[model samples]
Target: MFEQALGIFLMLAILSVLIVVHECGHFLVARLFGFQTPVFGVGLPFGPYISLGRKWNTEFRIYAFLLGGFVAIPELGDETNASNSSEAFGVELNPFKKFPIWQRALVAVAGVTFNAIFAYFLMVVMFFSVGRQVEQTYVSALDPSNPIAKQAGVLAGDDIVALDKHPVTSTHEVIAYLGNRKSTPVTLSLIRDGKPLDLVMTTSPKGKVGMVLGQKPAQYIKIDAGPVETLGLAGSELVDRTRLMVVGLAEMVQALTPDFGPAQPGAPPKPGFKNLHGVLAVVKIGAGMVQIDWRSMFMFTIMISMDLAIINLLPWPALDGGHLAFMLVEAIRGKPIEERAHGEMVKWGFLSLIALMVLVMVNDVSALMNGELDIKPEMKEKLKGR
Candidate 1:
């Protein structure tokens, strides 16, 4: 019970910190460019709030709901509803705009830029503390009816030594090799029961052997990395993780179609409401990470930070990317979008986000009631191997 409470606190704290960091990026860049920043809020600018004094012609505020934060730079020209959105939210804009389009673009992108940087820094710290996780081709489960592997004598807990006589240490390597040669004969060199064994099998047309791969902490050997090497590794980690996330998001959208099919062998079941995590889901799973050690928290925080950055980069209404899209359209046509249309779109977008949040919460509640939200139970079994 205590672990669960601590996990909830940590998740909320991390979300608040990420939001503030993202907002700070915009606040700093706008101030640097001498923009008329009327308000810099620590929390979402809504409802009852307390003023935290004024500095540099800017009023700082803390709102009642502290889930996210925002900054208001009047010169950036989100002044569609000056009387309502601007004044009601303490974000009143001056009549005249001063900054050029390019400068506005920089200010708009700074939030995501800061998020990316923050993720990288976390990666560096994690690497320095516990080193990078090395992937191993360790077999955790096999299909009960896997005739070829069973006939050729493959067993659970075997270390996959190679695929087709090519030495391999990672499951990804074996997958890539098979994917390139579909429906082919394969030779697996494995180490089982402290003895080397060979297993030959014909893969499915999709190049699957019907085995589940899992790596525990005990199977990972960490290597000390130099500073320069760590920088390269950190940058590579960011790029790779971002690419995987983008692919996963695209797949999720595709799976929403009416004719969506089951995932390929060994792939996770297609994500939907049940697997789509939100605040409740994160807190539940985060409790498990908290109980494990600091390493889990580091990975979770880094990934969540990057996720926030990526989500903001999407060209959806009321997002930073949407503002950039508007600027782009203006750049092409030499005039900004119509004020009414912009205001309407932003209003609807904000509503849509709230709706999405509510839907996710409902799904989370259902999953919790079904006894599927807690991760601590599974962690007990998995951690024993580690």
Candidate 2:
């Protein structure tokens, strides 16, 4: 129970910090360009809020909905909407002087830019402390149903280097290979205590021999990266994680089709909308990770930061990327968009974003009830090695 509380706290705190940093990027860049940002608030704009008074042409306040942050950069677009008022904030939107396209673009991109920078910074700290995690095929435990491998003297911590004389890299490879050859005799080349041995065993009919696998530094060793190497690795990690998210998002969209079916058998489900979730699942999974090792939060935080950056970059209204897209259209047209049309699109986008959030929340609840979000005990034991 205490673990659950800590997990929630950590998740919210981390997210709040990321939000602040993102908003600060826009605020600072706007100030740099000498634009008056009438309001900068932590959390969403609507709902009951308390004003922290004005500072440097910005009215700082904390809002009740603490999931997102915003700054009123008047030059960017229609900063004063129905929920927000320039008159209430005691600042006037400049009527005559608006920043050029380049400046507006910079302000729009700054939030994402800051998120990227902060993610890399976190990566540096993690590399220096816990090093980079390179997941591999290591047996962390033996299942009670241990049929062949356990009886053949396989033990925990044994690295399965090759199976059937072919090198196997990830746990997925090992599981897939064994699952396909159920009840068939196969040779496993394992490294135990730094020594290698070949053991011939037959898998159960289900293709599993009670060997449990672990990923993300649980069953693998860490590589302490140097300064230069860390930079290269950090860059690669950002790109890799971003690519994975893109693929996951695309799969989710594909899953929206009527004909899509479930992926994977005798293993974890493949990425799709069926498994796509929102903040609830994040807190649940994050709490599980925290209970195992606080260091795990670094990876979670980095992923969330990158996810925010990517999600905001989507060319939708009510998002940073949407604002940038508007700027692009404005650039080509040689004038700003009609005020009412732009505002209407933003209103619709805001509603769409909320509706999507509600749907994902429902998904999160359903997943929790079905026990799909629970962390496997075998994986937990592997992380415990730290």
Candidate 3:
């Protein structure tokens, strides 16, 4: 019970920090533009609020609900009905519509920008402190009975220099190359006893290349990166991770669609919530990670930060991307959208977000009740084997 409580506390603390960083992006950018930001809050506004001091004339607040946060900029079409009395203290209170389109767009994008930046910062620290895990591409073992290895005449201790003429530096690259060329011929360049050789091998029916690529024993070697190199590494990692996340999200969306074909005679029935993960699933994952170690917890938090960055930038209503889209349209049209139309759009957008949240929560509950939420680690190991 104590462990469970500790997990919950850690999850909340990490989430709260991420939320504050995201909202601060908006708040700080808006303040820089001379906009009126009355409330900078952590967590959704509910119950009584406690004042956490003021910055730049903004009242920092801690609310009851801890799921997410907001930066209440009264001038930025805020629905909070906050008094404009503070407007008298500065330049005439200009509505968000009166601001330059670029400035408004910047405010809309600032939150996502900060999330990405935070993720990159976490990655840099991780690299400097714990280092990254990497694998070597040398062949350590070969199964003679495996068709691909036998046909290619590959021997143990050979380093995979290339696949299809592309340099292979890691076992991951070899697996990726073979996985994509299942049952197809692939060219493998090998270095054996310091002599280079080339061979063609066809993958087996199950996409196995029948080679066990070797890895140096795992060790944490901190990267000694200069300022410029650190920046370059951080930015590159952020971009690569974001791209991978997009592909993964697309796959998850595809998994949501039901496969209508009849099941094979002896095959097990398809699971209803195969790739869906919701709030409870995330919390459960957080709990497990915290129990393992701080490095694992930090790693998960960094990934979540990046995920939030990408998710908020998705071009859907009530999202940062959606707001930026409206700003872009205004820029192109030489005018802001009609207030009523904008309100209607926001209403629909909010409802859609709520609906999505509901669907995800329902899926999470279903997975929990049906014993599907606990298989993630096993599934991850299986994927790694592939």
Candidate 4:
């Protein structure tokens, strides 16, 4: 029990740091652009409670009741009182209100950008701390009954060059490209017998491109340059992995959309959507990762970071995307939305967000109790050995 509690606490701490860094991106950009951002918080609000006066003027005061480590930019474009008529009328620059629509939009997007950058940095650290591991390619032993390799006559040693014309340099890339493919035949370009060749490989209903490339451990240590080159390599690796994740997610979402051909009638029902997991889910996942191998832990961290970026960019209220949407509207209308209306929109957004969070929480709990969250026995044994 104590171990579980410690795991939960560790998870919360990691998540909190990630969230704070993301929000800080927004706060920093807002301040840089001359907006008066008064409060920076670390967690959801627990109501107006007196904060001990700290040396760094970290004393707490609550002006609004919604909890979440959030930043509050001063009300924009509201000058009802005579005392600040000039400021309201734009005689002086209203940092929040006076910015052009595009600038305001960037301030909102800064949070997601921060998440991406942080993920990249963390990825670099992981690479240096532990070198890359690649799985061996094994296409030779494919079942003769498999339609994909049979039609193409793809041999095991054929090095994959491209998938449907897209470059295939990495396993993650292979996963993303294959995820987008239908069961139909895909043209695979490969190098065989030291000659560039193309094959019309039919994919199986499972969507495999029908050829596997061999994998090996290829680690390069920059003993001379030490930290700098390692960091750069990690950054590049992060960008590569993040791109793959984003592409995979986009394909998944596309499949779920109603416009995508309805899942064949009577086909097994798709897994239910679990879109808005909140802090509790975050804690549980983090704890679970810590119990896994370093590779899994790092991969999960990157996945979570990507998830944060994608979700925050959706045009929903109380999200960066929401602010972006409003900024776009303001741009088109030639004026910012009324402060009251904006506030109401934010309130509604918060309510909807909370409702989604609750649903995800219930799903997480069910998934845990049902043993859905456990790693497979084989995988668990493998990781344990690692």
User: What lDDT does each candidate get?
Assistant: 0.75, 0.80, 0.71, 0.63
- What local lDDT does model 1 show for residue 384? 32
lDDT of 2 by residue, 15-117 (tens): 8999998999999998999877888999888877889988886889899988778898766785454334556555666553567889888988999899989
TM-score of 3: 0.73
Alpha carbon lDDT at 374, candidate 1: 65
Cα-lDDT of candidate 2: 0.80
- On TM-score, the candidate that comes out on top is 1
- Give the per-residue lDDT digits (tens) of candidate 1, residues 105-170: 999899999998998998887777676644457788887755555656667799887887876655
Q: After best superposition, candidate 4 residue 44: deviation in angstroms?
A: 1.1
- Model 4 lDDT tens row, 1-386: 67667767776666766777787887778767776554455556444443433322222333233224665454322112223433432233233355666667777888889888888777776666655433322243445555567566777767666777866665566655665676766777777778988888656666775455443323233334467886776776677766776776776676556555655765665544654345666777567656655455665676677778888898887888888888778878988787778777877888888887778778888777877666566445434422
Cα RMSD to the true fold for all candidates: 4.2, 6.6, 6.0, 6.3
* Candidates sorted by lDDT, best first: 2, 1, 3, 4
Lowest lDDT sum, 10 consecutive residues, model 2, at: 214-223
Q: What is the lDDT of residue 65 in candidate 1?
A: 86
* Best of the two (1, 3) by lDDT: 1
RMSD of 2: 6.6
RMSD of 1: 4.2
Ranking of models by TM-score: 1, 2, 3, 4
